[model samples]
Target: MKMMERLETFLVLAECGSFTEAAKKLFCSQPTISHHIQKLEEQFGAPLFIRTGRTAQLTRQGEIFLDYAKQIEQTMLQAGSAIESSMKTESSIVSVYVSQYFANYYFDEILPTLHASDPPYRLEINAYCYEALKQALVDRKTDWAIMPYYPDDDFIRSDFAVHALFEDEFMLVLPPEHVLMNRKTIYARDLQGATVLLPRSPFLIRSLQKEMDRHGLRVQYLQMSNFEVIKQAVKSGLGAAFLPYRAIRKELEAEELTAKRLPFFGYLRQNGVLVRKGARFTAEEQAFFERLRPHFDEGAPAGRSAFS
Candidate 1:
């Protein structure tokens, strides 16, 4: 049997923990599955599994082998994808991880342009929270990530390149009946002694706290992770919270929520594109980025600004 076939059989056996189950999964007879594993063990000169009466467990050697098998499988898959992409005039698959806010607001506008190009592309958007977004990039599960402004991290700076796409300011969201709701512009000091609902992520919360500290203001609030939940809490008069202006635009326009611009918040969140550093872009991705450049430029006039 071929090495690839043996590797596939081994992976299935590891996952299913039985020859019968692996056979069923691979749609082959039990003997065929057993034969593949037997050959693999013979070639490696090590027992791969600890056979009990009816169950099997991976030996220490098996565990190490499994890791390499998985890596090989992934590399093979990536190689196959690369070849398939080359055969086509343009590849359709472009996977991306984008924040919920960006997916909801800007993806549609960008899609039309991508679709209009030759060798049409299909965009798969994975909407993830902060941590998941970073993981997707690290795992190479996504071709790109769209995220809010973040502090420069060594990993991201060294392994990924970021392009600024747009920017929006943070605003205080308050219930219409709240005391601060009537203010044309909200100051951080107004939050003192108030139950402010803030996002629970340490990175985001810390950034907000740092900004408040610089201005000698303190906001005391219960932290919640879900943005929608925070909005509901604010609307129900539970507390005030901060959100990007774009995120609350509809609510502000409909008067469902009142948003006061925070002048004291010196920095605006730059929504940007992130691509893996030193990774060669497929032709389609290169073309897609080229087309996207103009739209990113056009967004600057609205509020997009560079951070020093």
Candidate 2:
């Protein structure tokens, strides 16, 4: 608590830019604010402030420490909220980080149903791209992350406990009038000399590129991070893209876009749940994960792939 207090005080002082103003905001003495900053500087073995004019300015070291100070402040606030929420609701809230596509396609439907289930458990979903999702897991901001499996991904292999939920096969999406629209199976070479709309996330983008390059296909890209944006871009005839079938179920069924099976485009992205290494799951958390399993691959063909 004392460490948190010091950090909170430092954050206020940094924001207010004056010891007196910070003290006024905190309802503490100006001397106390000065003392707190001094203590932090001593602990870090550097000066935190440059005392000049009316407002105190952060030194180079203080600027670097500001980020950590802010993080500590946020953690403290979440901790307080958790305690209050537990007392009122008696429900444990689970924080989850989901990929943009998974959140839009599945979480949109899944959350409402979960909320109304018997013995309801609270779930908070934070949507991020692959890189941001990985960082959220490592930073412990989320209890679990729902993301796609990428080849040689160290986050899945080393730092987290993973469960293979289901496979979501990619569908090649093209405008209705495209040349490859009638093809039952498309090859990577078919995409050569064409612009492929893909997410800006490095991991997923790299995964897409690697598979194409494996088949000696070269292509241009119209890159955007969000699935909806890419879907719209494909619809606008920007270019063709490979996307999860579940995400574009309506579009596929409505014939808003044409989908072709890409035989040589062989990257089976397995979506899974990942938790920080060695974190023990309570019964509620375990049940929540179980409840979501059936909905994991809604795109699965009746007898075959999850993303049909």
Candidate 3:
């Protein structure tokens, strides 16, 4: 018999305190129990039990082995339980995390199609700010992520794979009737001293600042953290802001905001699907990601074409 099986027999016999009783409990004959115990004692090079008239008593060595045997059994049980839990979680649900921007602009656009396809697994999708989403991806707390910003860290690059889905431009957004609407082309210097709405997150604000510095543009800032709020502010003629054109496509179509092309801001943000390197995804999970990629149009708006 295997060492583990022998150890299990030893544990049960030790608990029963009688060879005959142990055999009865294990649904085996008394001689079979004797054989297993004898094999165990021989392997350990000591007597694990002492026979007294009708009862079996543990020896000193047996007590020490008993502790180790119990520990091994408990470890095996816990390992089994953890693996089972992991399997259930993976098979039943697909966990995906998205940046706040992607969730806001693309989630509703994609949901109806996803539902119509009738996927096998349930989806638990969460939207987080850029910083929070980055942290979650680094910690492996999410199975998949869709975000615009990719961390420039070597560890992240080596440990994760990023599939570029689509590109969206960060254009100069202004109220439809703003003075700049008449300008055929907008340059960074054109907005000098203009009040520009800024995202509130420190990480995002810092990134925007670096881009502005690179282009040699200086503007007064009005901080509004939420994207929806920023769009509202622009519609209300609060200020001109730099925002992803796709994010404000509907508003632009309705003439609520006038979007101007800024050559310097082009190709600044590429939204992509991010996943851990060397992960074994379930069939359902893989199917979901495959279906999702086609919804984003490259170098254009979302929901247009497959990744090309």
Of the candidates shown, which would achieve the greatest lDDT relative to the real structure? 3
- Candidate 1 residue pairs that clash: none
The residue-by-residue lDDT of candidate 3 on 146-211, one tens digit each, is: 886545555557877777877766778889898888988777778888888988877566667778
Worst 10 residues of 1 by lDDT: 299-308
The local distance difference test score of each candidate is 0.76, 0.78, 0.79
lDDT of 1 by residue, 89-204 (tens): 33556665788777776767887877887856777668987777887888888756778757655566777667777776777788777877677766666777777788866667
Superposition TM-score, candidate 3 onto the true structure: 0.65
- For residue 17, what is the lDDT in candidate 1? 91
TM-score of each: 0.63, 0.64, 0.65
Q: Lowest-scoring 10 consecutive residues by lDDT in candidate 2?
A: 299-308
Ranking by TM-score: 3, 2, 1
1-308: candidate 2 lDDT, tens digit per residue? 67777898888989999988999999999889888888888899999999986579999999999998888778878999999987766447766678877887887688877888886768766888778877777777765778886757876677765566777778788888887877766666667798889888777788888878898888888788677889899999888898878878889888888777777777778887766666776666667776777775543233332111
**Residue pairs clashing, model 3:** none
What would the C-alpha RMSD of candidate 3 be, to one decimal place? 9.1
